[model samples]
Each structure stands twice: as structure tokens, then as C-alpha cells.
Target: MTKSDFYRLCGGTFFVLVSNARKPIQSKAECYNGITSGLTEPEALLALAKTVIPDIPKPMNSEMKTLKDNTRDFKACLSNGGGFFRFGDQAVLKSFDVRVRQDYKQPLAAMNDFMDEFLDIKTSTKKDEYLVKGLVELLDADKEIGNDEIFYVRADGSTMTKSQILTASELCVQPFLLGLWHYVLTVVRDNKVGKDTYKDFCPPRGGAERIYTKQLGENSKREIAITYCDIDKTDNDFTEPKEHIPGENEENRAYKENDTSSANEEAASVPGTVINNNPFFLNISGGNNSIYNHVDKVEINHEARRDKGE
Candidate 1:
């Protein structure tokens, strides 16, 4: 694959993964394991890419740096490693690290457009045009110098052409990108950031309830109701109970009606009764002697009628 084609296919994902990998939120050991494992078994990476690619930002035009400057910096970051170009130069790497971190926080659509412009093969600046011409001249010189020499070698000790190496690099990078993506998502979810976007990208946390809310009417007369299963009940057959204080058994917990006892051991007990722990459930204070019973199910019935005056 050509460089532009590869970027078109995996550029957004590659940028996100590499930027996040530089500063993993999880332990370094775990992050490394995720990447290495992906390299061995690339199926996971392909699966993740299918689900993740759609959400990744598209390439946009960036004003952060001039095209000429960015292209020069990009070329400096790469070194020909006999067969292929590999990342090199500590200063260039550090520069990219800072740029990527800031780029990641930019509005998704804008950042995506910037990446596209950054990777564009056609140059708009005279300086960048000269750089591209110089690169072409270097490639021509290499062809003349190594006309009979083998340049590309595979892990299995087989020979490959430069074109084949480009395609191989695409395959190799997928696994590494997959590992980084996994670690980044884990950190984001754990820290509870990007809730509005990443929540849909990653799997829901364990023991999280799937609540659905519905609106019954419009304007002032609208009534909103939420529906969810009480997964804590025995009928639900959930293996794990809701999180609570350590050493406190949920089964032994008691619910008191109209009693203001501070001690758990002294509170009155109601057998086979479950408490509604949902935050949305109304809790009446300054007691007018009201007790809300927990029900296993709730059904809402609504009917619409037109007024005679209308």
C-alpha cells in the first residue's frame, strides 16, 4: 500500500494509539502486555478497529504548524532501517509527543482534518515541494547504488520488495495500535472522563444497571419515567451484589420504617424486603410518617384524549 492509502485507512487510529501509548494511564507492564499480545494474535486488533474506526476523527487542515515545518519534522523522526523507515531521533520524538497530546484534546472533527492535511502527499508550500523532490532524488540514488543488493528481508529470512514492506508495515502496526487502544479506553473509563463519547465506544463496567428513560407527554404536562431491573433481587439471579462498605453483609442489613436509629444493629428488620438504592427514587425527609415499599416491577399506563374545546 502507498503511504497515503495507508493513512486513509488507519491514520486516525494510528495517531490516537501512538499518542496514548506514549503516556499510558494503566501500569506499564499491563500496557506492554496488551501490545505484545496483539502482535501475536492480530484478530483482536482487526475486531477492535472495525468497531473503533467509525468513531475516530477524520483528517482536517491544521494551523498549529506550517505544512513545510511539519513535513520536515516528520521526515526527521524517521530513519531508514535497511529495509524500512523506523521512528528515530529523541528530539523529534519528544516534539511529536507534546504535539500529539495537545492535538488529541482538540475538537474531534478539527483534529481529524488537521491530520489529513499533515499527511497530504501533494504540497502547497514551495519548501515542502523541495523536500518531496529531495526525497525522490534520494530514492533514485538508492536504486542506482543497490541495483543488485537485497534491501528488504522478512522475519522468516525471505526477501521482499519495498512495496511489499510497506504493506507488511501496515499489518505489523495494527496489533500495536490495538494494544494501545485497549489501554487508553480502560484509563478513560476508569477515570470517568469523556463520558458523553467514550461510554459508547467501550463496554459497560461490571454491575452497571442499564436504565432506560421515557417521556410520556410534551411541555408542562410531560412526565418522565425511568425503567431498570433490580438486579440485586434473588429473582434476577445476579452473582454479585451492589458495592457496599467492607465487612458489611448485605443480607444482614435492615430497613427501618419511620425509625431514626443511628446503630445498624438496633434498627428494626423487615424480612424479604429490598431497598430501592436507585438515586432517582424519591427520598422524603422531615417525616410525615411515609414509607415507600420496594416493588419487583412497575407498569405505566397512559391514554391520550382531545379536549372538546379544541
Candidate 2:
């Protein structure tokens, strides 16, 4: 079976086998919750598996027997030196009774061949360097966002401790690792610094038109026209007013007139005062005595403008 298929079918069994040897009994509700929600502890998961499948046995076949017997040894090899060694290969392969072909020159090679053939487990030539890199990336991304204090969130929305993630990394749990990698990428992408060029290709073709004009040259008249047409077709097209409220037009005109008169009066009172028709622009003028001299900046409320259909 493929690695994913094997894990899918027998992940619980493998967890029990590689976990603490003594299996505990769990309540029916706990078992159901553990299996369904995927938030239970490994020990609880093992307990639940046993409670559901009491007839589960070790040594069901030669392949299983080899895997069951050698997994601990393999784990030990990794724990001792953080990698497989030539000397430890024989001990790791002791459970596999198959004879190594004469063409194979080394014990490590023979062990790798048997493990791959029987258990779908391949020995990495890099000695877990890639796994370490993945773990480091995950941790770094977490730290970058000040999430180092928080537990890692799994794909199931359950939280995993740092130690749990580390253990899973060591065991090379494919699903967990894939989820963690995806999370790390998301974190990195979210916290990434720089302009988002992808949005230029999205809707609201103003940015796209500018990019196209700049890159393809202003001589491309047809493309520019097409870009303009696309922009006009969008929902943001404001060429014509969509709605008319009763007395709304008159109210706005009156407000603008009053605001202009107030501005004109204020300007008359202050020396060296300048006025601009655009409410969004600040009415700045020379002389420290001007009323606007105290105003460092002006801000426009776009939400209010949108509400008023400006």
C-alpha cells in the first residue's frame, strides 16, 4: 500500500504500537470523541483504538511483524545519533529475515531496500536534515508572528504542543507535516513585506491598466481600450448616479454653500488664507497666524462619502 493509504487505514494501530507498550482502556464516549474530533492525546487515541478493536493483534503477518519489531530499533537509532548509521543498520534489519542480494554492498543499503519493500519506508540519504529544516521553518514562522507562546493549530483546529510537533517531525508524520508546512507558508505569506503585484491582475483594472500601459507601451491602443472597457464593465463604474433620494440633492447643495460661506468668512478674518473647493484638500496658506497653521494634516472619511453617494 502507499504510505498515505497505510497511514489512513492503520494510523491508530501504528500509534498504539509505537506509543507506550501498555494500552489503557477508554470509555465508549471517549473513544468516539477521540476518533471523530481528532483532539485526543496519543495515549487516549491508543486506548480508544483498543476499546473499538479489541481483537487487534501484532504479528498478523511477516511484514507487520518486521515493522513492529524494527520500528523501536529504528527510533532508537534516530534518537541516539539523530540519524541512521552503518553499524546500526544490522540491528534495525534484524527482524527482516530476507537475505540481502549480493549486489548490495552495505548493510545500510540492504536495510533501506528491505524497509522500502516491506514497510513503504524509505531511508533518507540526508539523515533527517530536510525534516529538521521543515521543523525550523515552522518554528521560525511561528516566532515571527509572536505565536511561539501559543500552541500550534492543527488542520483539525486542534492545538498541538511544541513537543508534540517536534515528535511528529521526528517520526515524519506525513499528514501532520503537510499541515504544518502549509500553515508555515501561510504565516510567511501573511507577514511578507513588499508590494502585492498579484492584485494588479485582479478586478478594478486601474492598476492593471497602468501596468499594461507601462509594460506593453502606450502605443498598444487596442489593449488599452480593452482595459478601459473592462474597467467600465466592473461594478465600481460610477459614470452615472444609481440612486436619487428626496431632497438629497438640494440638501447637499445647501451644505456646500454654507460650508463655502463659512470658509470664506474664516479666510476673511485670517491673513494670508487660501481656500480650495475640494473638501478633501486642506486649505493651507502662508503665515503662522492662519487658522489652518495649527492643522498639521487633513483626512477624508471615504466611508461617509460612500454613504452619501459622493
Candidate 3:
């Protein structure tokens, strides 16, 4: 559907219901982008998954120098030997690495928007402490999570409680957020940076849990901009070694319609960087020693969600 079609098809507000109440956060509520409505999380996300048209806005000046390669924060993605798209910053690419994988452009834009919108979600909360307690207990019961793990949140307005994240993991189809989380957490655990060392990492309050970058040398002080998106955007303040660290294939698949196997430019392939190649579902933080070349944007298939347990 076109942008207007998306806007016309959506509802006023979106709600997520996982399990029965009594446990706060068992559901979540939010407004859509004033576009599609009443979309079960799946429907909204599927719509959001529409491929982006590759259009790398050109830098005004012709003689600018770029740092896409030398900069630690930027990561470039290539799909199936096609063109490449730079993530993190468009400005950086103009001066340093102006990759022209225009075909895979749509997926990069959509994927970034998808991931950004999913995480760091803003909502109105009702201050349900009881639900928080229950969630803490559930996390406490999780075997894979580390010992220092804890749920941290900050709410100001009216928000619901949880029966969702824990009790109804089955029904709670948080496609966008959970899928992004799966990829990120897998990267974090594999990198071992969030295990600690985060400036916002914390027993310290007021900050959300995050993974920080290690000191690259005796004179660097920026957090590395690491993520699962395919486009490269590094100004390189705190980037890690140039390496791929996922346990499975990381392809940039952006189809024009319901077709996953076909795309305009062979999809986006993030070159240079390789990640873990394992196809295991729920492998979570197991990409520590695994790294493979990712060639396209995330393949938005039904199986991609299943692989991520969305």
C-alpha cells in the first residue's frame, strides 16, 4: 500500500494484550504514526516492512572527504554483491564513503525506521509498581539472563502493567521491538560490552541498560555506535575493530511486494563486516566468536520473525 493507503487503513490507537490482567504491563498501548490503525502488531509491522526506494541524497559540495572506513561508528552493508548503503549518518557518507547501492536503499530506510521506532519507545504509564515486581520475578527466573540483570523503566503518564512480556510470551507478538531486540541482544552478548562498562549501564538509576564501547586506545572517549542495521554510518568516535560477529546470515532483503525471493537490486549487502552465521532461533547472545559477511537488509520473511521468536 502507498503512504496514504497506510494512513487510511490504520486506527486511532494501538493496544497490545498478552495475557490476563492483575500483572501490570501485561499489555501495552500506543498511537500509530497517524497512519495504519487497529493493526495487530503483525499487520502494522508487515505494513511498515514496505521496501524503501534507494535515494542517497547527494552532499551539496563535490569535494568533501569521508570517514566511512576509518571512522569507528559507521558500518556499511551490501546485498548479494549489489550496491551498498551507509548507515548511522548520511552526512558522513557524502564526505567519506558515498556507497551507491541505490537498490537496497528502501530496506535500509525501512529497517532503520523499523528498529528505531521499536526500541526507545515512548508511552504514557500509570505507575503500576506491582506489575513491575512480577516482571522482576519473571526475569529473575530466567536462566539465560545473567545474575546482575534487572528490569529498568521510567514512566510518567498512564501506562499498563505486565502479563504480556512474561506470562504470554506466546501471544505477545512484538514484531518490531522484539525482533530488533533479538538482533541487538545477540550482538551485545556476543560482544560482551553490555556485560558492564556502559556509562548508562546500571545499578545506577535514571538510565536505561545499554552496552558501551571499550577504550580503543589511551585517548578515545566515545561510545561505539554498534547496531544490526545494514547501512553504514560511522563518524568513528568509539567503534570497535572492523569485524562481523553474528552467528547467522545478515542479508538486506527489501522486496517490492509479497515476494521475498526477488528484489530490484538483489537486495542490500553490507560489505566488509561479517557477523555470526548460525540459523538457530533464540541463540540470543551466542555470536561471541561467530562472524560472517552480511549481504542484504534483514530478510523480512515469516521465518525471520520465527528465527527471532517474534
Candidate 4:
């Protein structure tokens, strides 16, 4: 009865509502793979909810963070081997409810991967490696490189095609993390981990001390599962369409506001390459302890339905 909402839009664009809808589907096989992995309905919800960073809903003014806003903080940190502290309210929600936790180390590792993704940039759709660091290698007299074709945006004032974006994302690939995802699925197969620990599989939010760190070394392997976020299927009791394609509903795509034509046009004139630096570290401050309010809400709904014999 506590329906999770997925918002989409007109342009072919999307974003995951990690608070309610976490698993955004990126491929067809990943869809079927999610079903066969023995993930129960609640298990799936718990898995998705783990990434639900507690914040109200979002900024009252839907005014988005410009590229400057998005990259400035991270860029500043990146200057001195990215040294600094992040202490601020999460901008997602309306009010500063939960204290934001900042893990400096995690973002540092992710930055290394982020820079790697910029290299060996390939056509996102194709498996071939297209050399992402071409522009960096050019080392023109100009210190900052202009928008290279390898960037996710397009040179023609349009967004990069889906395939192009995929190719560019490879620059983010951390060989240390290579096949780390596939291993997680196998761990779930062996029951080494349950949905509760699923979030740990991806990047640093999973926990402290990155798996790629000296801790993991050669013998370190873990369970990982790829979750698909079907816009309509927040709770699994509902029947899934034969094909669980994303964006089926244009009006309710997850994070649909990601489209940035205005930003793209304005950024074309701007110079300097900005490394992506979204921090996923845990918040030290404690507030509304229960990110699982949705879980309680679901129980209330179930009780109400039973009273009505629904």
C-alpha cells in the first residue's frame, strides 16, 4: 500500500530514486538475473533501502546544482591529492533532518577510478577500447583541455548518444574493481551475504576501507548482485511485465530532471576538465534513526488492508 514512486520524463533520460527506487536497470540480462537470484520481495526492498540516504525529500526549489556547484567542491579537494573535510547538510531533502556523514577516503579512491574512466574511453555501447586519455595525452600548450569528444556531452550542443555515454563511462572503470560485481552474485548464490549487506558491494558506500585497498589485495573477493530498478515495481508483490523495461512511464521516470540542455550549452563555452567527485561516505551525525520509515509505513498499510480484509 506504501507505493514507491518512480518519476520519468519526455527526453530519453533517467535517474534513480535511491530513497525509494534504488536499482536502476542498465541492461536486459540484469533484469532476469535479479529475479533468479533468490531475492525475496522484502529482501529487495531492504536492499534498495540501504542506499536511502536520510534527508527530507529534496530542496524546495527544484533548482539543480549547476556543473560548477556539482564539481567545485570535489575539484577543490582534488587539487592537493584531494585533501579536505565535507561537513554540510545533504541538499536532497527539504530540511536538514539527518546529519550528513562524510568519508574522505572513499571519495579519494572513487576519484582515482573516476580519472581512470576518463582514460581508455571507448564507445559506451561497444566493448572495444577507444583510448579515453587521448586528449590528456595531447598535452597541448593550453593547460585545460577543451571539451573532448570523449566527454559524456556532445560537441554539437546535443547530449552524447547512449552508446557514447557508455563508452565514456569506461574511463571510470577501476581494474581493481573489475569482476568485483560478478563475484557478489556468486556470494549470494552461496548465501555468504543477504540483502542487508548488498549495498557494500558497490564502491565505498558499502563500508569503510575500500575492497581495492591493501585489505583486499589478491585473495579478496566478495558477493555482488546487479539490481534493476523497474520504475513501477517498487514492491515485488505486483506482477512484473514480461519485459521489465525502464522509462515505460514517461511522466514518472526516476531522477528524470537530469536532462541539462541549458547547462550543456553554457558549459560548452567554459574550459577545464572537472573530475566527478560525489562523496558516498557514511555520515557521522545521527538524526531520525530510521531510514526504514517506509518499512513501517508498509506494515501500517498491510494492517489497514487486513482490517478491511483487502
Can you write out model 4's per-residue Cα lDDT over 198-271, one digit (the tens) per residue?
22222354455322111111221222221111122122122323543566566454443344444445555644
What are the per-residue Cα lDDT tens digits for candidate 2 across 1-310? 3211211101222222222222233567977777443222322322222212222232334444444334333222221111212112334223211211221112223222222222212233321233333333324323333433333223222446554543443332332332342232222322112112212211245544211111111112221110000011112111322345659889999898898788777676654445556544453222222334344233334455556676
TM-score of 2: 0.19
Q: How do all models score by TM-score?
A: 0.17, 0.19, 0.18, 0.16
Model 3 alpha-carbon miss at residue 95, Å: 25
How far residue 302's Cα lies from its native spot in candidate 4, in Å, is: 43
Q: Give stretches of model 1 more than 4 Å off.
A: 1-115, 119-124, 143-145, 148-310
lDDT of each: 0.26, 0.30, 0.26, 0.23
**What TM-score number comes out for model 4?**
0.16
**Best-performing candidate as measured by lDDT:** 2
How many Å off is the CA of 309 in candidate 4? 51
| Rank order (by lDDT, best first) | 2, 1, 3, 4
- Model 3: per-residue Cα lDDT over 1-310, one tens digit each: 3211111100100111111111222123433334333323332223232222223332223312232221111111111101222222335333221221222232334444543343222223311222222223323333444443321111111112232333322211122222222222221223222222122111234554222221111122222212232344322232233445544333322222335434422443533222322443222222223333543332323444567676
Q: Residue 299, candidate 3: how far off, in angstroms?
A: 60
Model 1 weakest lDDT span, ten residues long: 211-220
Evaluated at residue 274, the lDDT of candidate 3 is: 28
